[model samples]
Target: MNILHLSAVNNWGGGENQIELLCREFKEHYPEVKNQILCKKGKLFHKRLEKTNLKFLTASLAFQMDPRYIRRIISICKKENIDLIHIHDSTALSLAIIADNLADLPPMVFSKKTSFPIRNRKQSLYKYNHPKLKKIFCVSKKTRNVTSEGIQDENKLVTLYHGIDPELQRNLKPGLDLRNFLKIPSERKIIGNIANHIEAKDLQTLVKTANQLINRENRKDFHFVQIGGFEKPRTSSLLQEVKQFGLEEHFSFLGFRENAAALIPQFDISIITSESEGLPQFIYESFFHKIPVISTGVGGISEIITHKINGLLAQAHDHKKLCENILILAENEELIPKFAEISHQMVLQNFTSEIMMEKTLIEYKKILHERL
Candidate 1:
């Protein structure tokens, strides 16, 4: 089968990462399954695709809609004789919806990566675009619910969780090299948060949590390390909050690093304070590295973590609860092994890349059979 996968950005965020992983494994598993990527030309991720056999097609379908871009996609589909077109983002969906309407156009599928509001104003887009789609793959139960409610065909909406390579989670080398590289003091008990510095992430909670640790005795034993960048305006506010709370010495922000699994193993615990999320790969990555997690009760997090089991969960935007959980983990070394065991089992049982590929291939074959 020939597949055309579409995405709008070049940034290596969660959705892009998911598409890349799928493309890589699909090519490996089915050598006969030729694949092409449709994305903005000359973006940062283009450089990262050098070694892959997948070909890329650049078109004008800007991240948002452009009528001319829809014409371009339809032309490419006809010229390339693509068997199926899989669009990966909301903007791409609009263009693909139109492109699929032309004569001899290929089957189209869409992956829903985010949860939609119950009364989403974007429902009109879904109503118009979803009918043209052969199937909709949602990243979590929440995503599935939103798509099912938006589209007329409940059968077309399927839940396929995000998967990661088991090997990527292995810490082949100790993180001491990274520690020395960052000049992190060797004696402090490190707690790491690996996410971008965005408003949704509520990073100031981490900074304030560090300050809370400082007021207690044995304060020198604990410290905070984060892996993310702040290009947006709110980063300035987060920086000011950290400074105002007197947490400069205890907190370190190690701007976006790819070697997260290696770095995570060195920390005592991993924390996530997101206001919302789908099933995040970070938790699985931490599980692979055998670290415990402290996260908020959001999205599909409960699907993986049982409170006081695999990881601890806090209420959204509750900085005090976040501080309380961090202190609990810091004081009790015994809980670490139990948490790690449960987490590792969770990854092994449900989130492997192999399982995701198997399920995806089945979906493709099922759709093909129905059309035949």
Candidate 2:
């Protein structure tokens, strides 16, 4: 089957990672399944695709409503004879909505990777409820629940958790030991967060949590190391907050590293302070590396974190609760490896790339058959 996967997002985040994984496995599982990726040129996503053999087209999105951009997508779809178009971001979906009105487009499926609710508006309705969009694959049940409420056809929405290949980042020797590079004392414990400086990531609560940890006499030794790139304005604001909280020494912001995955082994524990997520990619990667995850219980996170079972959960934006969870895991050293094992086994059994690709192919086939 011919499939066209499209993502207009310039940054390479969890959704892009999932798309790349899907493309890689699509090639391996069905060599005959023709796949194409259309993404922005000179972006992180394009850089990741340079080594892959998957067919891809690159373009820049000056504006979302640009008819030229829509034409570019339609032209590629026509040339590739794409049977179906899988949209990964809202920008692509929006353009597809406009493009569909101007041309006879192929069936489209959108992957809703975030748990944010869709606005009940004409624009949201056109992008989601349009006739061309055949399916809405949500990364978490929470995302599906929130998204289905705004849409007319609840049957079009499906929960498909994001998965990872356990061995994908194995054997890559990172040139930099993050702890050593950061000049953090060898004996101090490290709490690592791998997310960009976005509002949804909720770094404000993370800063507050760090302050709370420092206030605890025994928890002062723990260092929170985050590796993410952000715009200067956001960075400045975050730095200002850290200074205000007197957490300058306790918090370390290691701006965007391409090989951030390689540094997970250095962390004592992995934490995600996001207010919303469609089951974050970092959690799966951290679990694969045998690092126990502590995250805010929001969106699809509850589905993956079984409350003190595989991993621990804190209420979103509740830094006090987050600090409490952190102390529980750190103080009880025995629970670290135990939690890691449970999470690792969980991902291996249910959230692996192999399982994701298999299920996706089944969906693709089922959709095509129904259309026929």
Q: Whole-model lDDT for model 1 versus the true structure? A: 0.74
lDDT of 1 by residue, 314-362 (tens): 9887877888887788778789899999888888889887788778888
**In model 1, where do residues sit more than 4 Å from their true spots?**
51-53, 60-63, 66-72, 101-104, 122-129, 171-176, 215-218
Q: lDDT of candidate 2?
A: 0.86
Clashing residue pairs for model 2: none
**Per-residue lDDT of model 2, residues 116-207, tens digit only:** 89987888876788887889999999999999888999999988888987767687566787677777887779999999888899988888
TM-score of each: 0.89, 0.97
Q: Give the TM-score comparing model 1 with the true structure, all chains together.
A: 0.89
Candidate 1: residue 20 Cα off by (Å): 1.6
lDDT of each: 0.74, 0.86
